[model samples]
Target: MAYLYYGADARPAEIPDHVLAHVKVVAATKLRRGESFMLTWRHRGEGTGGRTSLWMQPSIPLRFVFDEPEPEALDSEYLRKLANEATSSRGIVLEWDDEAIVGHPGEAPPIDAMAA
Candidate 1:
């Protein structure tokens, strides 16, 4: 699991390491270009039963903590899809998906292709 800490609030949003990794890339790209967006996610655990959205900007302090020692390979197609969602009216939504860690919406290349 990974945690994304923003602002002075002690409670950080917990996400999977792989998801957070992709989010980091997408967010950094947007922030670098001075774009702000809302990031929405369903709150898990006791006492937090609903969804929450945060306004992400370049000015806010953000921190990402990952439990994994090494970073995973990024899927460009997945990143593009995420970025598109973030810019849309619905905004970016983070969800828990075990399959997303390896293969996402786009087709995953064959093992032989990866070796090339």
Candidate 2:
């Protein structure tokens, strides 16, 4: 599992490593362009239901921690999908099933160093 630590409070949003990889790409791209938007994701935890959304800004603190030591190749189709959503009024939404974004562990090669 991967954890996205957001804000000064360090509120942790649990995301699968594969899905987080995609989110990281979108988040980094937006933040680099000085864009602020909302990131919403559905909860996958046992007792947790519904979803969560955050106002993502360049000024705020955000960290993406992955259990995997190395990065995985990114999915271009998924990346395009996320980028389009991010520019929309609805902003970006991360689905739990998007974990299929990357191949498992050694099954794939590493992505860009920036994504690491």
Candidate 3:
């Protein structure tokens, strides 16, 4: 699993590839536009049993990791669907921690940004 963080904060986990693509696009767009927002995710578990986490940070200064590096761009329609979902609901989000995180896990942890 991979973890996606906004700025220096953890967002979501176990995120689907498609949704992750959308999130990247959205986050990139926001960064390009000089905007930022809160990002959150379920770092562990599934559904009601999940333990959620959040982080607050800028949109552009983000890091993405995988078993392999992800492509820069993704399908537009799929990304649009994710954006729609985010707009419709809270979407997969992150919980904020007062302490700052400046790096990602060296190994792939069972925590993906979009999988949740």
Q: Measured by TM-score, how close is model 3 to the native structure?
A: 0.47
What root-mean-square deviation over C-alphas does model 1 reach? Answer: 5.0
For each candidate, what is the lDDT? 0.76, 0.76, 0.46
Which lDDT tens digits does candidate 1 get at residues 23-107?
8887887887899888988876668788889999999999999988877566666677678877888878887654454336654
- For 8-111, candidate 3 gives per-residue lDDT tens digits of 34553555443455567666655455654545554444455555533323534566554347553344444444445444435535332334211221223222
Per-residue lDDT of candidate 2, residues 1-116 (tens digit): 89999987756888888778878988898998899888987777579789888999999989999999988567666666777878888988876454453222223444452322
Clashing pairs in 1: none
Candidate 3 regions off by >4 Å?
6-14, 46-48, 51-61, 70-73, 84-116
Whose lDDT is higher: candidate 2's or candidate 3's?
Answer: 2
Model 2 worst lDDT window (10 residues): 101-110
Q: What lDDT would candidate 2 get against the real structure? A: 0.76
Q: What is the lDDT of residue 12 in candidate 3?
A: 31
| Candidate ordering by lDDT (highest first) | 2, 1, 3
Residue 113 CA error for candidate 1 (Å)?
19
